[model samples]
Target: MKNSRSKPFVIGISGGSGSGKSTIINEIVERLGPEKIAVLHHDAYYRHRPELSFEERTIINFDHPDSLETKLLMKHLVQLISGEKVEVPIYDFPQHLRNSKTKKISPCQILIVDGILVLNDSQLCELMD
Candidate 1:
């Protein structure tokens, strides 16, 4: 994991879409302050299905785990676990995909992951174990 190389503490949060994970994250951020913590959105992990265009991906059942880019997310997860800096892709919900530029993240004391189906993948489940 790019962010975990330093053995940083990890926190994973999951829920249905629009489940207010952000609100909770914001509250935690407020309590912890920007300096003490870091957060990651699972949407950033989505694999780029170049074969599937934005329209096709959007038409699919996004609420289901199959719609996610599990591979890419796993890569980032590995990086975080390994304690390395990562440039997380910014996924566009409206476009139903990630853009080119990515947001840079460096592991801090605590790393929080929030998303809808992040834990649904068997790979991630194993990682969680």
Candidate 2:
């Protein structure tokens, strides 16, 4: 007996590099049915550097949190809670910046965000509260 009224129970799945985060995400979607789930990749939130030259964007190590546009990510998460569609930025790891185009995400019964560094931010942890 699960609570069916909760709108999109957000589950943050994280692990070290090469971990099974993607596998777990797929499993959740499979068990719950695609209609009940939506997956968001943290990689889509990497910081943008429209000011930086191509060379500068390429040399940075993107594994750290600084490389991510977390503030924007946090904002969109809040918007989705209100059942609004959001435009999630697309990031290029090798380039170390967000792509020119964005991805559109709609609200679902369950939103599962999967990535290596997911839920590492204190602000994000508080948002769940």
Candidate 3:
């Protein structure tokens, strides 16, 4: 069913690496029904460094907020909230690079932004409900 509200109810989930963030998200999605929710993972927004070699990318601290394109994520969130669809980037963990293809995500009743740094950024926090 389509969301009747003008904006989705945004929820931000954050935790350390290896934490149960994804687990929690999965459970929530299951209970709430995936068809009524949209999930955006911060890890999927890691900055694409095509110029850097695989070795160099590996050395970079993936945990650091600078390693992600938070600005783009924020923009996408805005678009989603505005009842627009977004093309989410696909990141390859093994190669430490963004995949050529993107996943199209539609706005839904609930928007779950999952990542360790989701709550770290003040601007991002402001966007959450």
> Of the candidates shown, which would achieve the greatest TM-score relative to the real structure?
3
For residue 106, what is the lDDT in candidate 3? Answer: 99
Instruction: Please identify model 2 stretches exceeding 4 Å from their true place.
Output: 1-3
Worst 10 residues of 2 by lDDT: 1-10
Better of 1 and 2 by lDDT: 2
Residues 1-129, candidate 3, lDDT per residue (tens digit)?
A: 455777899999999988999899999998889888999999999999989998899999988999999999999999999989999999999999999999999998999999989999999999998
Ranking by lDDT: 3, 2, 1
For candidate 1, write residues 1-129 as lDDT tens digits.
Answer: 133444656667789867888888898888877775767787776655668876787777766676676767667767876778788888777776678888988867677777888677777655542
lDDT of 2 at 19: 87
In model 2, residue pairs whose N, Cα or C atoms come closer than 3 Å (at least 3 residues apart or on different chains), thus clashing, are 8-109, 47-69
Model-by-model lDDT, in order?
0.72, 0.76, 0.95
Residue 58 local lDDT, model 1: 70
Candidate no. 3 TM-score:
0.95
Candidate 2, residue 10: Cα displacement in angstroms equals: 0.7
